[model samples]
Target: MTATGDADLSVVAAALGDRGRARMVLAVTDGRALPASTLAGEAGVSAATASAHLRRLVDAGVLRAEQHGRFRYFRLAGPEVADLVEALGRVSPPQPVRSLKEGTRAHALRLARACYDHVAGRLGVALTDALLDAGHLVGGDGADSGRRDGDRLPGLDVVDYSLSADGRTVLTGLDVAVPDAAPVRCCVDWTEQRHHVAGPLGRALLTTMTDRGWVRPARRSRALTVTDEGRTALVDALGLVWPPPHGPDRVPGERTALSRA
Candidate 1:
């Protein structure tokens, strides 16, 4: 293995150190390529300044730029890059907002959004909880601290996660293949400050949802809007119901599961 001391960590840190460049990176963290002009606007910079920043990122191997005639589109170099951005959010303080719109956007992000390839935020935590409640996935600070020896430990944050026999059946029934490696893992959600599921199983579940049309990307945003069919399917499969019916500004049936924080 290569020595950690020899790694180019500083290069990546430097690339992200700039506010303008960082905003540009966040704009494309959604696993999509965007034109330089779009990224420029995101950074609140001029075309020439954005070009310089993007070129630096490209050189750092943090982003990839593709040539399409007169326009160049940029995207994160790979999944690792996306993961880095997501992890950064976990450590960074929340952005300050001066208006209700900004606050609302932040709230929407906290409601449901993707952490790279897997679900995250309240929605992500809810899905994981549902899987446990349904006995499809078994894990947590359950009896026995999740040990095969059956030692019970209460109040533990999370020990681990594994698919039960029923989980395997249900997943296979949905035509989603269980991952062969690292099938179960936990990700600390930045917004909720709690653990949500990740790893192979999480990816498969998200993919199946997208394929089945249960969720769709929101316009110009990372938030995912659960469809009507999705709401029904979730209620059926996991007994998870959303929407508390508050009144105006309420999206009917828009439920996000919240557990013991």
Candidate 2:
């Protein structure tokens, strides 16, 4: 890399340096294009202040604005931006919870939330664990030699995950229309410090869960809640017992033995 490249990197870093701006960036990390007004609320900033922040982010190429009729919406410049944010989260310290609402929101996010269009948090890590235990997915040990994409760089938390034949059967049974030749990958979850499904397979799973009302997004937030029906269905289909039994031996990301319905 050249000196000019270092300067360019610093510009992007500066755009994400502010608390308000960082909040705004994270608000859209789930791949949603949000209006400036909503983004301002997310950042807890006045409209004028948010406008300046958004402009800086746009100028730094960290985010892009789209004019949708009378409204302008902002989103991450691309998947690379989202990836960068996720990477940063892995090393960032948790923000202190200052209020009951903040504490609740924080817990909810750590329990279940979306990470760039896929299920993340504990729910995601559990699902990945369940799949692995069931022999539905394989090899997420950050060994790039086993990675499906040979040319791809061994970036942050690059796990060599792939779907097994049984995984195809499981998705088909769940009525998740697997995209043509979709790649299965895993992301090292920032909060859980464990693997969660990613790539095309992860997107398909999230879509299926949402469509089936298994999980619903929280209003104005990326957190998700599992429905009653979903709870039952997940157990029957994947042997994923949610709200796992409270016990001294309970492990994070642990799931019941895979039981096919």
Candidate 3:
């Protein structure tokens, strides 16, 4: 077999070599399609500078751009890019919590929120537990797997997730339609120092919950608020319970919000 030209990894590495461009990529990896101006602010650079970097990322195939009237939105090419960002985040040192607001936001993200297209925080942990306990997910039993005996509930160390045969039956019974083809992947939550469901199944769960008005996003922040209906549904459908009287508090620097996952 002939060698397929040089790997694109070099190009990807070069594109991410700049601190500014890398930050831009991280900002948009949240699964939010962002305009160049918003990305510029997130990268702390001028719009012109961000545009130049964005062009490089687009050319390198690390990002994709879509134009809507006057605005051009950019996002990571796909879930593969999200996976790369999450892996890098796992090894990268955590940023210090600078202010009371930052600390609060971080806490909120760790409690209940979305990381890109998937869920994270305490809400995310709870959902994962409910799925596992209900036998909706399986296959985390190998020696190399993250799960351990005697672990606490709502643990986020799952190596992989899949809809069990019973899970499909349960979903069908609940009238929650699932796609014929869905991807199964994991993402690391920086704030919680744990992993959460990502990929198709994860996205599906988020969409279902949001559509059912079980949860809602807090204004101007990535934090999620569980509604009364959400609490009842979670308990009734998945056997999960929310912590009572939940309130915001500060977490240390090492554990912060998930950047990519």
Highest lDDT among the candidates is held by which one? 2
lDDT of 3 by residue, 1-261 (tens): 877986668889899888889878876665778889888887789988989999999999889999989999998898778777766765677667999997897777667876767776777755665666667766542112234556533233345466788887876675666556543565555554554666667787888888889889775455788888888887778766456212122221112222211
lDDT score of model 3? Answer: 0.68
Q: What C-alpha lDDT values do all the predictions have?
A: 0.71, 0.78, 0.68
Give, for candidate 2, the lowest lDDT window spanning 10 residues: 244-253
Clashing pairs in 3: 30-116, 191-256
The local distance difference test score of model 1 is 0.71
Q: Estimate, for each residue in 27-133, the C-alpha lDDT of model 2 and write its tens digit.
A: 98888889999999999999999999999999999889999999999998987787788779978999999999999999888888888778988778777766776
Point out where model 2 deviates above 4 Å.
1-7, 141-158, 180-183, 244-261
The candidates, ranked best first by TM-score, are 2, 1, 3
Query: What TM-score would candidate 3 get against the native?
Result: 0.74
- What are the per-model C-alpha RMSD values against the true structure? 6.8, 4.9, 7.4
Residue pairs with colliding backbones in model 1 are: 143-152, 144-151, 144-152, 242-255
Candidate with more favorable, higher lDDT: 1 or 2: 2
